[model samples]
Target: MCRHVVPASASRKALLLQALLLISAGMVGTWCVQAITIETVNKASEVMCVRYWIPNEVGGGCNEVRMGNKWDIQVTDRWKAATVWATEGGCGGAHCNTGPPTGVTQFEITVDGGWSNDYYDISALAGFNLGLTVAPTNPTCASQICTSLSTCQGVVPGGPDRTKACKYGSASYVLTFIK
Candidate 1:
């Protein structure tokens, strides 16, 4: 009986291992670059709420306020301090359905100038007003809208003294992704 055998080459083994190492190193290097290049829109976010128009009630009120689509003030073209109304049920998935008979849908956008730049703080929202910190954060592209409508904080009303608890002085948006 006769048997045939194939010879193993040492150079071939070394070359195969070198190729694998190069590929692994390249993958690691790509991930590192992507990690450092990723960023978000300066803590900006939106909430969803349904509007309710009741029947025959005074002071912007109605008799039977039924639930409407979720909505709130939305920011668009954050540059030049721009924003507008974003339709309800379109806030993506961050909106919470808080049952029926809802009167207001609150969408809040918080800018992170520093730790102190908050939205809920009444005093801060009323004072030291600053423009937005992002661009094209969002846009519906319909009517030319005013930036005032999209802000949780508005200009201080002129009068003797009237304080509302709707200050947006301490809100910020942050998201995390796993890859």
Candidate 2:
């Protein structure tokens, strides 16, 4: 019988090369970076709403509206701040939608981590009078701001505010993750 043995170093190199090839081919999906989840909380008395342009899974854009209270927004671009338009309004009693853009709040940009984690800057931007605290540590955030949209604080309004809630505020937070 013929004897055959692969050197330890050679075996390691081959494995490393294989791993690199897989990664380059986009086959490896463990530690890839993709999007950031922007979570928000509206502390003001007026209900908050948001309108953003997120690339949908299909191809086009996901033009969505996230009502105030608490929302989790999934975004891809880490540099460009999400174009969010907010307003103050709600359903009086019956099904009501559409809230005028009276309280439009711009957002600041903050980035953390590299190819794994994601952080954002929400200190300030423009046209936003409401206090927006990015990555808040106050306990009020958890209690006041719905941890997830499922149990979010406010209800979806009828008219223009009919979209889902993904707006950030003084109590807004950035929930980082790796894709």
Candidate 3:
């Protein structure tokens, strides 16, 4: 009878240890989740390279999986805007360099995605951004795409600010990036 009692006592002790271990794990997981929220904030900034697929012509919108070149640009009017912004994930996600920074002509916020997402307009969007501009997705001259692309295709993933230019066209695709 004494041996039986000793075994049962040990089992209860083991069970208590296991319970404590599980509770500690749950607490650590909770802390980690909270940390992520804060981390993402620190990670996000205004100036970043925005990846885009600009059509070669205005009449035609570009949508190939090609990576576009990125530039350094600003996104602030003052105050919150004054802080430098930085980001990666550009050029079809290949040229993701947030090291120095990047630039663009202008920016806009489009609600087409039902999320009021910000997008930058490209000069090429004029043809597509207009009330009506229709054409196939290819340029007349495949080699000389951007040159002869006058009104051929108007695309926007960036702008020079409202004062510099107002490119008001509903963008079909634009990826807003932040560091």
For each candidate in turn, the TM-score is 0.17, 0.40, 0.17
> Ten residues in a row with the worst lDDT in model 2?
54-63
Q: Model 3, range 8-54, lDDT digits (tens) per residue?
A: 55687797786689787784222111100000111223222332221
TM-score of model number 1: 0.17
Weakest 10 consecutive residues of candidate 3 by summed lDDT: 31-40
Give the 10-residue window scoring lowest on summed lDDT in candidate 1: 30-39
lDDT of 2 by residue, 1-179 (tens): 12345566787779889779988998874432334555655554355444443222222121223333465665443433334333444323422223223334433333233442223332222333444434433344332222233432321221323222222322334421110
> Could you give me the TM-score of model 2 versus the true structure?
0.40
- Could you tell me the TM-score of candidate 3? 0.17
lDDT of 1 by residue, 29-143 (tens): 2211111010122111232222212122221111111133112222211212111112222234432322122222222222322342312111122322222222221232111
Give residue 134's error in model 3 in angstroms: 12
Greater TM-score among 2 and 3 belongs to 2
> Which is the leading candidate under lDDT?
2
